[model samples]
Target: MTLYPATLLLHLVGVIGLFIALSLEVAVVSRLRVAKTTTQVHEWLTLSRVIDVLLPVSAVVILISGLVLTFSAWGWGHAWIELSLGLLVLLGLLGPVINGPRMKAIRVAAQAAPEGSISPALRQAIFHPVLRVYVPIPGLVALGAVIMMVLKLDWL
Candidate 1:
């Protein structure tokens, strides 16, 4: 197969993986919100860390494949491609700077405390304003990028 088809396939698969990861995050967050036991919190924290690893991997695949696509045929000068690239970069920056450290702190707290009851610190971290604000941005931005790519919507 050609590089274009291969890269497009990779990009599409990456988007699928990222969407699944995002959905998992949402479901886990929902569980965390209603978690009443330490074990529940701990489980969610562990899952959060595990999924964090996978999430970034999918994102990187999407980005690298998109880059490959751009250089091959999409071209950097096209406004739609540029917008999609911009949103992907935004999401790439958003996750590490925002969600990563916050999740780490929660995981640490969960690990330190006994597996009997959920700690206030852990709960607060899960509900932290900064986390709450940034957690959904990447997914939303990814969705926007997908929309722009699919619809070829270029304002410029």
Candidate 2:
């Protein structure tokens, strides 16, 4: 049950897309803290929109294609593969269900807050307490995915 090279290539593309999206999210947030101008704020908002829409889609494609490759390459019931895919799904779901609404609230607040008085309240909401937990989740999951893929732990 070998995978064709083309399918593997597509899966890799999805993975890379997801990675890029996450990187952009980090960059956008970094700029957000010092976003002095309205235009800068708008740019960050637009980036957030792109991330909100595209990141999940790319993640879905990555997970589905990874599953296809896993089944085709190693068959179902492989322990580490199942665990890895489940974790991927969890990571994907967390973005929309937990992070999306929070980010939207932050964005709306940012837009409403007048220039030069982007208050601490607005910044606090945008970089909420939950972010202390949420921001690191993807990185850890991605790291685990890499490790599991490389090790192929078969603990059943």
Candidate 3:
């Protein structure tokens, strides 16, 4: 196969991996929000560890493959390309700046609480206002990037 098609396939695979990681994060956080017991909280938090690994790996794959595709086939002049790269950076930052610390706090709270029902502190940590606002941003940004890529939007 040609370099362009091979890189395109890799880029698509990366996107699929990214979506899977993001979906798992959402599901785990949703479960953590409703967890009645510390055990359940711990369980869900353990599951989130998968996201910690998957998100970065997928993102790296996406970035490398996307850059290759851009340089090889698409060039850097398209408005959609620029915006999509910006969105990818934003998605990268959101995980570390917003989601990571908040989830760490929730895990800490879960660890400190007893094995019974969830504590107020744990509940608050799980349902942080920031997290509530931040949860949908990644998915929405990713969706927008996908749309732009598919449409080859050229509103530059």
Select the stronger candidate by TM-score from 2 and 3: 3
lDDT of 2 by residue, 19-98 (tens): 77877777776687676665676778788777877688778788778877876777878777788788888887787777
Best by TM-score: 3
Q: Who is ahead in lDDT, 1 or 2? A: 1
For model 1, the superposed segments whose C-alpha errors exceed 4 Å read none
lDDT (C-alpha) at residue 147 in model 2: 81
Candidate 2 Cα outliers beyond 4 Å, as residue runs? 1-3, 37-39
TM-score of 3: 0.96
What's the TM-score of each model vs. the native?
0.90, 0.85, 0.96
Residue 59's C-alpha lDDT in candidate 3?
A: 88
Residue pairs whose backbone atoms clash in candidate 2: none
Candidate 3 or 1, higher TM-score: 3
RMSD, each candidate, Å?
Answer: 1.6, 2.4, 1.0
Instruction: Give the per-residue lDDT of model 3 (tens digit) for 24-124.
Output: 88898888888889999888888888888888988888899989988988898898888989889887976788888999899889889988999999999
In TM-score terms, candidate 2 sits at 0.85
